[model samples]
Target: MLSFPSRKHSSLRVALTALTTLAVAGGAAAIPTTSTATPNAAPKSWDETAYRGQVEVVRTPEGPADTEYLTGRVFVDQDRDSASDRRERGLDGVVVSNGRDVVTTDRHGRYRLPAYDNMTVFITQPAGYQVPVDESNVAQFHYNHLPEGSPELRYGGIAPTGPLPDAVNFPLVRSQLTRAQEQHCVIAGDLQTYDRTEVEYARQGAINDLAGRRDYQGCGTLFIGDVVGDDLSLYPDVKDLTSLTNGPARFLPGNHDLDFDSATAEHAFDTFRAQMAPAYYSYDVGDVHIVALNTVRYPCTPDVDNADGRRPECDDPENSPRYNGRLDENQLAWLEQDLAAVDDDKLVVVAGHIPLLTFADEGSAIHQVDQVREVYELLEGREAVSVAGHTHSIENMRTGDLVQGWQDLFGVEGLPFPHITAGAISGDWYSGELTENGYPVAVGRDGGRPGLLTLDIRGDSFRERYTVTGESDRVQTQLGINSPTYRDWYAERQAWNDNPEGAAPELGDPHVVIREDLAGQTWLTTNFWMGSTGSTVEVEIDGRRAGEATRTQEMRGEDQLIGPEWSDPHAVAQQLVHGGSVADRTMHLWRFELPADLGTGRHRAEVTATDAHGREYTDVLHFRVVDQP
Candidate 1:
């Protein structure tokens, strides 16, 4: 986990890793193999101070000059034995650039290159190397370019066009984690390091992000789950990774974290517990009660034949994979007790790996629990929000009780609770190629760029912002509604898009105008997933109030968790198989009639939505009404 001292060191490691694997041939690119030390060089005393300086890496076409690359300077630990030393030389061949593009150092250990603003330029950890660190045991490396500066790029981030400078340098100094620093929390999901290489990959990916900068030192990072793949041995590596973070780090359990050797529910997460602490617990942070839950139950299906089926002890466990995803009765009971203790006015944020509901394939199954609504019902009227990760996608669905889209099956309509899918820290399982920054450019399922989620919790009201990878600013809201036309298009597209090995067309622009044919029996529908079951949707026409709406879910059975529990097969298949309406009412589909006797002028239709807690959200739609001849 704690691989190197600074971001430069880690990037150098990734660079070494990548270079080592590269097919170094005549035609293939020759990565600069520079070394910080010479054959006759003396082993200088190690510097003890953290390195603090500016650094920037830019992308450019192959230069006309033989030495088109630039040479930049970065300090090693400055205070050697607590005193400033002039003997240290710049680290050689430190890979630096935004993750996509890269550049190496000159003989003197200096690096220079074209400029790219608002980019995160970091060092690619050279293989078999280290960097400077502060007294608090946190690494001090990596540099950021807010080209337009910080606290102001609230609009779209750095401009792509350049008025760039020639150089950016980083300074080094020893420092300690301070209590007075503002608390910045890093929320990471599923490191899931499978092997040593993956462990290093994980280290290189996040360590660079953690190296420099001042934010996230107080609250530290809270990894939601799946710290390693099925192998639990990577926990120590995860610990090492967190040690590099500027603040305290915590974790929750994911499905893969379960003890494969365990025979019963009680001993299910023993391995995970041994490595990352308790499976289910809670802590207080800045007026927020963060509860980490272990939703994966050992034997997915409880067998009456097994001894102590109700409360099976781990010591004499029963081996079964029946419980791929779920919160056992005991944990549910614990949650009820834990939540009951919190003050109604205080904010309670429930964090877990498997979401209560999600847009992924196993959404209803491994995604959420059958009793999810029951849990939300308990939190009703309280300041609360649910956050989970397993889906590896960024989804922010407002909660309400009007079932139309995905919520039709459960018969639970309206806002039940606001549930957020915290997209993975290893976005798309870290599947992309290395960026010059030495990290992967992993994207989300919803096409939302990935990085992390930041919740600015101030008292009862909390604002969530999704910080996309590579982009400094966050996308606050994902607009677009579910109407009959878009629904039909989605249906046609989904049914024929199953070619696994074939090239596919784009899912189309995520941002689009959802066309709706309001004439005839057509209606404008909104499916607030399960969390919106108890919420309300208010429709207003031309400044006049229209009506209030409710959400509905299709319930299958008392034991069912995901998918269409009580779903009518027709409605459930409609998203993939379109036709006439199904027998059961689908809450994800909302219908609104166009007023009669209207002319061909543009009119505004405002839809105001209120969640279970009475929080109001307003969305205005522009449509035209034409007269029939």
Candidate 2:
């Protein structure tokens, strides 16, 4: 999800190029706008792009000159239309922002802050209210303010506004979506559609699955980024797919959805805002406050010696199209204020495309946030949890689960709250064989089956569950036996796959292991999709206690270990033979080292997974231990 371009262009040069192209096309670009009565005092260009960039209308405070402040009002839409009506009165206590600065509406429902250019002005959706959505089901909650439109860019970066507007008002419709404490929040990660074909795959897969389900109409489904694979034109296709959701659909920008050809970072996500969503925004439902952050920073300039020992001789960010995960100073400041306004008892659900810390990509500095500790500090003592995607793995990392990268890069040790990677719907970019439903079985990198994560919330507390595509909730564990024969087959398959001329490696009986294979090297592995710190996996051999299995990664600030020993044999056996990321090391794999004295007969290990919340699930696996053949 990088946007590092081959070359850099100056802002002026970018502007000139845009102007020339528009002139040649015989039309300056056009933006989409909805019809609204009782709109603000009209005077400027009606172009939706330019209109969206207009500064909030003038507000002459009874204060000083150097103290310029932004002004806005939040009103209840008496009529369901998006515009504010005269009969519609102001709604007090509604929070608004200029990216970093946060302010609440006064008694009259008006807010003011120091105004600035290139700032995204938005209103946080209050409890008992819902923001409007465009035809694509994208939430409408913010306005972009820029004096001049984007520099030379593809996907038509925002057109210039030239000046501030007379007034900027947000209208909220009374909705059941945000009024209750009980909620089902839908979280889908990494749609990552590459083209029309993949778009159809999404439709048949998660989209179709979502279509049949009538749940989550209130909390709605939020698609965390990597919405598309670098192609801005596919935005319409992306929207078409989103229409399948039974509830309101919203989006967050990912690195992949950037205008890489843009001249400045300011215009980087302009196309995303233009087509899919705001750079970032927030909304409220029940006791949970969802703060969606734009954590992707493009063209991330690295120091002379990058800390990534894994990738030495790395090219400069300017020379490569890499992106770093970071929250801008403004967003961070805004977050502090936003949190300050919220009651500590309220559950804060922070969502972003890139994770703050992950069991996957622990060594790469750019993959995780640079200021995770700061975010943690802002939410300190508050009941909170985070959701992210980008690693294409499902991880349910709970509090006290240490991330070594956080300690090394940000000096953070244990997770303050649960951090989950919702797992990508694209499922390894829609890799592997097509199912009868006309979709691929794109298993995830950590061997998690492609699925959507749902948060069943009551008050500030919640229970998280992952529902695999085309499967029921009971299918949570993936069972496999890690044996010498399988490991040998793994190595041999890799060697053959590396050569185009080599014959295909066949995976014989997957559940068969000989007595010789039972040396201390063999073990029973289980990839529990929703497994976390307090979770336990107990193995019973033919109804007897074989003892609790040890988790592969303790997540206690230790280094990550990968390879055959850490791999999910069940996932790899199929993923490698089909097509998908290898089921290598994962955060959820638990193994029970097989005893050397077991009998040489087909035996069953009953695994009972008990989560941190005490909910339990059972799964079984059968394997044979014949005499050495």
Candidate 3:
């Protein structure tokens, strides 16, 4: 995974000032001109899944007289109109881009870039300035420069621009909400609703949770990639879902949200750019500057050499149509410039679709960023953290948490900052049985419940919390046990569930255990969904102090210990039969050895989990130690 966003070949930052009345939705009238170039058309058949070079970049000849120069001004919109007027002062030092090369606005607040057939000219909404939002509350900060709209596109790609406008201007409104150091930024992972029906499920799930709340209206809600599942048409439904939020909604594209039919990597996210949001962008709210990135490179090159760890080469993109975590060069340069402008006192929050590194699937080369150290170096002295989706798991990796996978794959020693996998809102791709609220249980691979991540920011410091969909924040850990009966049920159910050849066998009372079972290798398990290396779990059985349970996956350069032994049996009880990803091995599982000498009776085990930050949460589970069969 690469830490930066995406890069396009087109971008210009020049300064010019022009006055014109803007239209609704922050769009402007076209500059009167006739194009002297032939039409630049999309191919009849373009394979977006192929490597970058495989697809051809088709362009038409631009006559010397037909050359287009894009003109735009960055002005302080005294009136929040979408256009620049005499009354508005052109803001100096604001950065703008033609999609690739970046430039700052001149004293006149005007910029001119060599316009391409298809490009998106946008500004890096400067700190203390707010951008305009359309009907769905998506920030309208860029001008789509497609002279002729998309061809053979599904999601109604950018509308055809008859000609290049005389100027494209940006508007900004000043707000105290964005100036405060304390900000509540909501980072929602993979709202990947495949169709209309799942869209409604989302409406009832996290969207419902956001509607009645009022915290994140300033820093806003960022849907960190996977906005849809291959269906570009569903972008509207995703937008409608965002309308429920009290804040502005932003988006990033994921592998599944790609325009796979597009011929080249440059236009792979065109439909998404047209419908959902920019491929990548940065905005600031209060003392926090958020750098939202697009990190998925589809149809990644596969490496067949390093099978089963004899170790050499690591470029597996998982066959055709799959993707890996990566970023192009342009974004990295823009990021450097963006960060250089910010004061050291400000907090930086970097978000992307794919994580730079994660505890789940730690050893998989494709699961973590290939350029994590570069990102770490970029933010060397700044207080920053990264949050991402795509793994369908929740991981709260703190600084200094080491895994051999990162060391081996990317030569990364340890994390430079907290790297959190936000645990997709489309948990397990919206799997499992439907809840009473009409949404799926969607338990994640690490057994994290479907939820949203909130970063409670105060100046440069922040606290992160996950609120499970349809459940309160208190639902942090899942309790389970391992015994002969549990293991037997686990094996039997997984088999029948996979094949479905017979009536599914029901698991007996999962929370209950017998003295005989305890004698025969019964162990209590606590799956602390967000637990990390420093976290601890302890148990008190029936008023007596039991020893502390040891955490699995010590995260110190060790290989994965998977299978039934490390599984969360409570999750397996449902997952083996349901549709979600199985919760087999977890980095946060704590196993307590059950005492073989316990008397035959009902016993209560009090479980306490202490997070890396010293915050403790407790829960109790009751199980019987009976003499029954």
Best by lDDT: 2
- By lDDT, the candidates rank as 2, 3, 1
Off by over 4 Å in 2: 1-70, 303-315, 595-601
Q: For residues 1-629, what per-residue lDDT tens digits would candidate 1 score against the true structure?
A: 11111211111122323322221100111111222111121122122222322223333564323233223455454544322235755555444443223455544455554434433444533322333344333333344433344222212222333333333443333233222112234677667777777777666655545553235443446788887887776666777776666554567888777666554555566555544545666544444566777776765543421223332322232442454456766567656655554555556677878776654433244355555677777787666778888777655556552323235333455545566776666765665456676656554443233466655444445645444444332122212323344445454445455543454323232222222244433333333321233456666768776776433332221222222222222122332332222222222323344454444666666655554334454555565443321
lDDT of 2 by residue, 378-427 (tens): 88877899999999999999988886776776677788999999998898
Which candidate achieves the best TM-score against the true structure? 2
lDDT on C-alpha atoms for all candidate structures = 0.48, 0.76, 0.72
lDDT of 1 at 272: 58
TM-score of each: 0.48, 0.85, 0.84
lDDT (10s digit) by residue, model 3, range 237-257: 887887666666888888888
**How far out, in Å, is residue 180 in model 3?**
1.0
Worst 10 residues of 1 by lDDT: 23-32
Q: In candidate 1, which residue ranges exceed 4 Å CA deviation?
A: 1-184, 302-320, 361-363, 401-411, 474-629
RMSD of each: 21.4, 12.8, 12.8
Q: Cα lDDT of model 1 overall?
A: 0.48
